[model samples]
Every structure is written in C-alpha cells, then in structure tokens.
Target: MTDLDTPAAAPPRAGALRHAAPALLGYAGVRALGLITLALWSAANGKSAHTLLTARWDSLWYTRVAAFGYGWEVRLPNGDVHSNLAFFPLLPWLERLVAALSPLSYADAGLLVGTLASPAAAWGIFAVADHVYGRRAGVCAALVWAVLPVGIVQSMAYSESLFTALAAWSLYAVLAGRWLTAGLLASLAGLTRPVGAAVVAALWVAAITSFVRERSTPPARGAFGWRRALGMLLAPLGAAGYVLWVGHRTGRGPLGYLDVQGQWGNGFDGGYAFARFVGDKFTSFPSALAGVGLTVGVALVIWLYVSCVRQGQPLPLLVYSGIVTALALCASGYFGSKPRLLLPAFPLLLPLALALARLRTSRSAAILGAVAAASAVYGAFWLNGSGPP
Candidate 1:
C-alpha cells in the first residue's frame, strides 16, 4: 500500500471528552449565533421559527414515520411517488423513543434529538482530528464544521447531525482499533442514511489491512483477532437489513430500494446529470453567477479530497470521505441539498483545519468569527426563503 494509505496511529484514550470540551463550547456558540439569526429573521417576517425548525421539509416526513409506521407515501401531480420508506428508520426510531419517554410530540422530539446531537457530532469531529493531528487542530476542525454554510441544518429536526454523530464516533472507533465498536456504530449509521455505507466501507478497509499485515502473527496477550472479523461481519448489517426489508414490503426483491429512490428522481449517474445541471445554469446572467459558484464549490470539494490524500490521512478516513463525496456530488436529484448532504464528511476539512491551527490564535478566531457570521446570515436567508431541498 502507498504511504497515503497508512493507518494513523491512535492517541491515548484518556480524558477524551474532557479534552473535547473547548471545541464543544465553541461549536455551541456558533450554533447559537445561527439560531438567533434565524429566529430574528423569522420574527421580522411574521413566521414562527419553531414551526420552521420542527415541522417543515424533510422534518415532516420523519415525524410522519415516527407517528405512523412506514407504509405512507405521496403521489405527485406529475405521477412521481415519494415514499416515506425512502427516509431511513433510525431518526424516526429515536424520535419515537423520545416521545414515548417524555411529553414532547414526535416533531418536537426530533428537534430535541438534533439539538443535542450536534455537539456530539462536533466532539466526535474533535476526537478524530485530535487523534490524528493534535488538540489545536482538533478544536479548529470541530469549529470549522460548525461554521459550514448549511450549519443550521445541524440544529434542525433533520437527521444530518444525528447521522454525523454516529459516523464520526464510528470512524473514531476504527482509528482507535476498537473494531467491534466501529462495526456497531457503522450499523447504526446505516440505519440512519444510505450514506452509512461510507462508514461500513471504512471499517472493512481498516480491518482488511490489519489482517493483511498480521496474517501469521499470533494474537497478542489480549487480542481477540476474532473481534476484527466480527466487526467486518457486522458493519454491513444495518444498511443491508433495511434495504432487504424494503424489498420485501415492495415485492421488488433486492432492487426495491433503488426503485423507491428512482421514484423520487434520485440515482447515481456518476455526476453526468450534475454536470449538465451546472451547465444549464449558465443560460442566464443571474443564473450564470450561480453556475460559477457551483463550479467553485465542486472544485473546492475535489481539491479538499485530493489534499486529504496527499496529506497521508489514515486509510479509514480516506475511504470514508471519498465515498461520502462521490455520493453527495453524483446524486441525480436534490441538487440544492448537496451541501447539507456533505455535512458528515468532516475529514475533508482537516487540511484546512491544520492550516488554521498554525495561525495566531487571534487571527484564527477573527477568520472563523467572520465566517461564522456569514454562515449565520446565509442560514437565516436560506430557511426563511425556500430552505434546502
């Protein structure tokens, strides 16, 4: 294997959460700014920010699944069918659990889950970044993730934050050589979103590499090599199980999930559809500016992934981020949701984080402060307008 594929050595696990506290606090501040901005904007427009965050867009679909199990669907005027099954089960399951345990409604429970999970995701990002680079970079990485333009989605009743929290800890587990833990988290991630496959892939790659490196070595004093094998076995279960169940319910066999996504006009076309999407935007002057922005955004994503590879990131991170990037960019539908979809691919931000960590603390704070303000305004503008698709 190339040096780029080398496993990043795990750090001492002691005081993990205690060490992440600073990043968590910073993340909370950024999110608070976003929520405040959105709330003020909504009030000026005579709208309820609570309703916007708790009962709109994809949030409604998840709430439906939580309140009424999954046989529900909507048939659009153009003969397109949108299935609730297209929404994964994990978030709704948690929402149901929260509702049953408390007085909150399903949607409110979803909002509660997302609000709490964002910090978990932030800390997980800090943990993985801290493990590879150092405490400073890890702190920067977590804050950078919170300041993303779609950062507000992390606070909404969506599944992005929850899935990110699971995926992050799963990757951290893989980095820490806790194979069974990684696999278990990967399974839960799969139940959260289709992109959960990325976590599963990371676990498999790391485990296979370990096996190849020590094929004949005796298990160490406490090493249960079987745990590695078990992790590999468990990683795919969540996604596979959900997909197969969809097949059974729809009577379309193993390909049923594809049919469901197809009905929603979603599919992987290797970015051909997306390329044409960007090209078509250039037909008008105003649209052309958006086209240029899209070009730069896509370019930035590619550059970051390449930088990650050149930086010699651990094999698990490379595998996980690569799949997540390809899936987000190559989807044939929901072009506007690309940024939100890319939310969990935090490893791509490492190269930027490391650069930021080297700057003077005051300078870094100023830069991120400015960016966080911009993100706050944009997030408010977005949710008040059409919001992310």
Candidate 2:
C-alpha cells in the first residue's frame, strides 16, 4: 500500500485515548471532589454551590451576553466604564447554542460547557506531554494541572477551560505536523480569549523557523511547505477580525478594543504596575510576607520557563508558554487574576511532571493525592470567598 493507504503504519487515535484514560479519570475525580467539597461548604455557609458555579462574577457577565447580545455597560463612581465587549464571544455563544437546544438556562448552559471542556483540556494537555515526554509524564502533568490552586476556575462557568482546551489541542497539532488543524484551532482560541494571541505567536514562530530550516535543506516531495505557510497566514485572522469588528462596532477605528480594555485599567506596562502592587503589600509584617511570597512565586514561574528553554522543549511549546506567562504577569489590572490567567500555560509544569514521573508510582500517587485533597479544600474556600475577578 502507498503511504496514504497504509492504515496500520501509525498508532490509531483510539490507542491514544486508551493511554490517556487514566489521566483523564484522575483529573475528573479530583474535580469531582472539589465540587463535592464546595457543595458541603456552601451548605454550611447557606450558599448554593450551583449559584457559586453558575451565577456569580464573570459567569453573570457571560450569561448577560448570551441572554441579550452585548451593549451592556457599567459606569463606575470613578467614571470608568466596564463594557461587556471586553469578553470574547465564544463561551457565551456556546452558552446560547446550548440553551437554545435544551431546557437549561444560559447560566446552566455555560456551566455545562465549562464542565465538559475541562476534561478535553486535560486530554489535550496529556497529548502534548505524551508526545514530548512519555505516558507517565503526561499523566503526571494532567494531575498537576488538576490540582493547581486556581483549578476550580476550570469547573466554573468561565472561559478558561474552553480556552485551554483550544490552546492545548492547537499546540498538539503543531507538534504533530498538522499545520492547518493547528491554525484553525488557534483561530477558535483567539475567539475564546485574548491570550489566544499566545497560540498564534507560537504557530508563527514555528512556521518561520520551519521555513528558515527548509531553506537550508533541499525540500523533499510531499513536504508541507505551502500548507504550513497557509497555516501561518490563517493563525492571526480570528483575533485580528474580532479586534477590527470591535473597532467598527464602537466607531473607534482599529484601536477600539484597546479602548475597551483601557477602561478596565488593563494595559501592558512591562510589569511596572504589578511590581508596585507587590511593593505596596509590604506595609505590615504579614503583608510584607505576602509580598515576599508573591515575589518568589513570580520568580519561580520565570525560572521554570527558562528551564523549559534550556531543556530544549519544542519551539511551539516554549513560545506559547512564554507569551502566556508574559501576558499573565504584565497585565496592569486585576492583580488577583494572574494565577487564574496562567492556568493555560501548562508547559510550565513539564519539569515538575518529569521529576514526578521518575519517582516510584506509589510515591507519585501519594503526592498527587495529598495535593489533590488540599486543592479540593482550597477550591471550595476560594469559591466561597472572593473568588476569581
């Protein structure tokens, strides 16, 4: 049989699914424990767990968009305007579709989408890790992600899970040499969140590197030369299109999106505002310790990213992780949301995942179980408290 007709030459996707099943099941268990904990805690506190997941904070904004298309705004006492246009449309659009097809409310539909997308995100994370490292490391990586402090956001009516799913699968496509699939998923990711720019940048960097490398070596037949170029061309369209549409809608030309973000006090200032915020936290002894903790956390994230580079990770993974880290750290507003924003940068967990994979299986499971229990309690506490902004 010719190359195209060779059915058994490659491992089937079913095999991959089988391999990833354990990781997915573990992730689901951790998430389920978190939900159950939240429910119990909410009952004690006289708050509904369902309300916590589907009706508060960003979830409310998303459902508003789904129920009534855009144009909603709030004028703060300080004269700042918070516009619904700041949110990307994909999650709310999905919410609307789900609500239209079923008897659920828009909020419930959003919760459903997030619930379903979380496992897909875990699967995508597993695929990327398995391709780069091995099955053991892949499972470890997914478990690590599931037990992250801010992981509860993945189960809420939020865009983080959906965005992570798209970003992970897009990166996997890049690694698998499926350029068009990468570009299309990257486009959808762009439609999901502003951080989708990271995925596009990764694809562009990889495509450019491929082109430069190919220029030195003679191209072979059936090489994905022009198709890779097409993927590069397609990568940025979704984000650019949305920005331009916002400009047209707001009549502010091409910078309209920036204006919307600006109203919310979000801008890139090279982490200056963040540093100042950290500094301001040093007024008292306890607050100073908090500042120190923040500083160490930021330093650790940067160090891990540098380790990824030194370890010679795939170019797309490095680029995507770097951009995600940079954007999460440098944004001037919503200091509390940085960790949650960094949830999609799963590549940062690879070094830890590798270390865990080297341990005895029982030891690794013990460590993961402890972390998962702590995470479940923290998630419940977090949602019951201030929660993500």
Best-fitting candidate, scored by lDDT: 1
Query: Can you list the residue pairs that collide in candidate 2?
Result: none
Q: lDDT per residue, candidate 1, 1-389, as tens digits?
A: 22212334543666666788889999999999999999999999999889889987999999999999999999999999999999999999999999999999999999999998999999999988988898999999999999999999999999999999999999988887777888899999999999999999998998878777765565552264677788889989999999999999999999999999999999999999999999999999999999999999999999999999999999999999999999999999999999999999999999999999999999999999999999999988898897667
Which residue pairs come into collision in candidate 1?
A: none
- The parts of candidate 2 lying over 4 Å away from their true place are 1-10
The Cα RMSD in angstroms, rounded to one decimal, for candidate 2 relative to the true structure is 2.8
Worst 10 residues of 2 by lDDT: 1-10
- Scored against the true structure, residue 292 in model 2 reaches a CA lDDT of 96
For each candidate, the alpha-carbon lDDT, in order, equals 0.92, 0.90
- Give the Å error, residue 6, model 1: 15
Per-residue CA lDDT of model 2 for 229-300, tens digit only, reads 778878888888888899999999899999999999999999999999999999889899989999999999
